[model samples]
Target: MNYFIFGGSGFIGTHLVNLLKEKYPDGNIYNLDIRENNHDGKSKYINCDVKQPINLNIVVDQNDIIFNFAAVHTTPGHPNHEYFETNIYGAENVTAFAEKFGIKKILFTSSIAPYGASEEMKSEETLPTPNTPYGISKLVAEKIHMIWQAKKDTERQLTIVRPGVVFGKGENGNFTRLYWGIKKHRFFYPGRKDTIKASIYVKELVNFMLYRIEMDRSDVEIYNCTYEPAFTIEEISDAMMKATDMKRTIYKIPGGVLKFAAGIIGALGGKSFGIHPDRVKKLMISTNISGKKLKESDYQFQYSFEEALKDWYNDNDNLYLE
Candidate 1:
């Protein structure tokens, strides 16, 4: 089967491409992104923007599957409008391309952000209350896919995966920062100990998606993807530190302290000390999403937080400890 991946240069996309190569050695996989594929050599790279009209020149078979991962998802980085423009427009263009090419299957990676930052555990049945532009835009993108599926009602297969804070080898954001802080033995609990930090190992996430696609289930299936038995911030830090064989002092600074500092910075027009008020606020809440649908599926997750940490810590490339 042919596989076409939009936003194939990003972290998840890169890993998915590798998985595709391993699973379908003879299949032709195309990676379409605004930027060129910088690492993986298995998949062919095509310079195409998902926000623009799809180019007809890129060959695709009707039996091929298209996975859409393009989005502007850096919560605090881009302006609000950028999220809607990239995510919504990108989904539209990709779905249009699929329709025009007679492709019947689409797999999308949406975010748990749609549920917003809540302390309660959310499931697929939960109604979305997306407050931020990134969250709102992702929910809209999911709707766009559903509309396309509805148009093709009986013929199309759509799998919408709402993944939580995916982390692994190429991830250099949140997980990496935490790793560094722990490595230096200065990591502290930023908020309450019970704050849930739902997440998935990138490899496991890609594996589960492939498992679903290979099953060739008809119609639409939506899943909230995260590792089972969500871990608290305290638990995560402990597991990561233990897995890495790091003996560090875990300190807890009351949530109020961070909030107060954030307030002072906001009032004085001073720059945030790597901790914005919004981020500090989020640290106190739990994004405990339920993966009931995925858990019920036939595929078993291969990596837990401990296993994922072991993989990364052992990989010299990933551990950039001085």
Candidate 2:
């Protein structure tokens, strides 16, 4: 088997690549990314930008299964245009290549961000109301995949996965920011501390993707990839504080006060605050998503939030803390 994974240099991508190599030792895996991956010789890394169309025929054959995981992702203070260009354009390019080569299966790694922040748990059936440009772009990309799948012949299959916040080694997103901040004794909780944040560990998400691909269903499917259990902001903060042995204060400022301060900081060109406005919004709002469909599909979480956090801390102990 030959597997092509875009964004293989990223946190989730690297973990997925490692898993694939171990699971299919005899198979060949090709990584397409803008930067070269630092993995061992088991996988081949190709430097390619997904935003631009590439002649994938040289690398990808009809027998190959392509996983489109490339994106600008969610970043604080990033321009909206960058997200659209990379995410939307990248999806278009990947689908174009897949259709041209008649690839049997193409798995798109999308985000739970498309469902947006909601006090109520969002399920697969919920209509998407994307709040951020990153989310909007991801939602649009999913639509593109659906459109292509509908128009394609009977040979191709498209699976769309809207995963919650994915965390693992080398991840520098909201998870890493909170983890390292707490580890370095710079932790702070904004607004209410009990907001539940939907998230999934990288290993579990990859496992689900591989499982679905093995099933080889013909219909286009969308699944919300997340853990059975959810974590509250307070719980995560407490866990990190305990793990790092930090005694730093956890402030519980009123939500309105924080929002006002954020508005002022935004007006001041984000110079007043060290963190970006988007990050602030994430901390304040609830992005909880449901994993009922994944659970109903008989997928179980391999690791608990506590276990994953411990692994993260142990692996990154020397690099960030020392």
Candidate 3:
């Protein structure tokens, strides 16, 4: 089987590439990314921009499966236009390329952020009320895929995966920030420590994608790729504290106080604080998604949160200490 992956150098993409190599040892795999990956020499890497129209006919064939994982994911500092250009325009370019080459099976990696900040459990049926440009772009991209799928000649199998916060090795930004907080032994708990956060292990998410690829049904499928059991911030912090043998001081700052401070920081341009207003809002909001669909599909997680954290801690001990 020939597998073509866009954004193969990213955090989730790297893990997906590794899993594909292990699962299909003799199969041909091609990675299309802006930067070349420095991993094992098993897969072919092609540097290309998904935002621009490019002829991938040589690399992508009719029988191959195309996975679009490229996007400008949620970043507090990123401009709104960046998200639209990369997530929306990039998705359109890739889908058009796939249609032109007769590639039928395409998997799009979307986000639960499209559901917005919800207190209720989010499922596949939830109405997408995207809050940020990142979320709006992703949701819009998925809609574009649906439009292509509706065309008569475009007999494509589209699988849209709305995954929760995905964490694993090589993860930067949000995961790195939390890891550093834990490693420094100064982890602070804002509001209540028991704030729930939904997440998926990278391996599990990859497996889900592979499963969808193997079972190619005619219907357009959408699934939430997340762990069955949701986790709380307090639980994650406690596990990290136990794993590192570190005693971190926990602070229970009132939510109102934090909001007020955030407003003040926002009004002042946030340059002096080095923290964005979006980050402050995210910290207070809770995200809990239901992975019932994934579980019902007989997908099982290989590693628990504790196991993932332990591996992460051991690998980045030096970096965190510094």
Candidate 4:
């Protein structure tokens, strides 16, 4: 079967494509994205903008798997409307394309943002109380995909995955920034040391996705993707330090004080001060999500907090600025 992957050039998508290639060396995988795939450069690339209608003259069987990872997800990074514009339209267009082609098998990579900035570890059953535009848009997009599946539940296969902060090689997101912080000796704990930041390694996440899709179960499956017993901010910091063998004096600053100071610095220095107040606030909050559901499943986790960190460190030096 062929694979049509939207946003395949992105951090997670690239890893997913690579893993898929490993499993099916001869699989016809198409990477559709605005950007090019710099990770493997093996998958057939197509210029696709999910915000617009995905009406390309493409040919694939009805059973070809479609993976949707298209969205504008970074918070405090994009304008409020950008989130809705990209996410909503992307969902509409992708689902529209799927319906048109009668593609029964589809997988969507949603976000844990729908759970909002909660201190409690939320399950898949947790009633989403989304606060941010990113969160709200994603929750809505989940509905959009579900609607498509509703048209033909007995035959359609739709798997929705809400993953927390995912990190690995080529990922220039939170974990990369954290690694940069420690490397530059600017890493510091905001507020308390116990704030849980639910996260997962990219490879493990890809494996989990494949495992679930291959399962002969329900037609529509929704689950939260994260490592169980999520790591605290301090624990992550310690593990990261040990992984790269880069230890420095990291001080725990109170949340309020750090936010205030960062706000002023960010205002004066403009974008030069990457440490914005909103970012500081995020660090203080807890995203302690439970992977209890995933754990209960037959899918086994190959990486732990320490092991994931070590694997990433040894995997590449892209984020490791000397």
Write one digit per residue (lDDT tens) for candidate 4, span 1-322: 8888998888888888889888998988898899987455559888999999887766768878889998998879899999999899999999999888888878999999998887877999899999999999999999999999999988888899988789888887788778777777666788788989889889999998888776655388887888887888888888888888876778888888888888888878855436888988999899979888887888889988788887887777624611
Clashes within 3 Å, all models in order: 0, 0, 0, 0
Q: How accurate is candidate 4 locally (lDDT)?
A: 0.85
Decreasing TM-score order of the candidates: 4, 1, 2, 3
- The whole-model lDDT of each prediction reads 0.83, 0.79, 0.77, 0.85
Q: Write down the RMSD of candidate 4 (Cα, Å).
A: 1.9
Best by lDDT: 4
Superposition TM-score, candidate 3 onto the true structure: 0.88
Candidate 1: residue 20 lDDT (0-100): 86
Model 3 lDDT per residue over 1-322, tens place: 7888888888888888888889898888888889898357867888879889867546557778888999988667688999999988888998888778877888999888899886788889889898889999999999988877767433668899998778767776565666676665434566777677888767678887898887756558889887767778887667767766667767777766766776787788864443455665676677888888877876666677777666666666723411
* lDDT score, candidate 3, position 28: 80
Report how far off residue 192 is in candidate 4 (Å): 0.7
TM-score of 2: 0.88
Q: What tens digits encode model 1's per-residue C-alpha lDDT throughout 1-322?
A: 7788889898899899888888788988888898899445788888888889988576678899998998999867799999999999999999999999889999999999999876888999999999899999999999999999999778889999999878887786667767776776544676668889888888888998888877655699998888777788888888887877777787888878877877787678764234456767777888899877787777887877788878767765545521
Candidate 2 local lDDT, residue 195: 87
For candidate 2, write residues 132-198 as lDDT tens digits: 8999999999988887788854666888998877877777677777766665554467768888887
TM-score of each: 0.93, 0.88, 0.88, 0.95
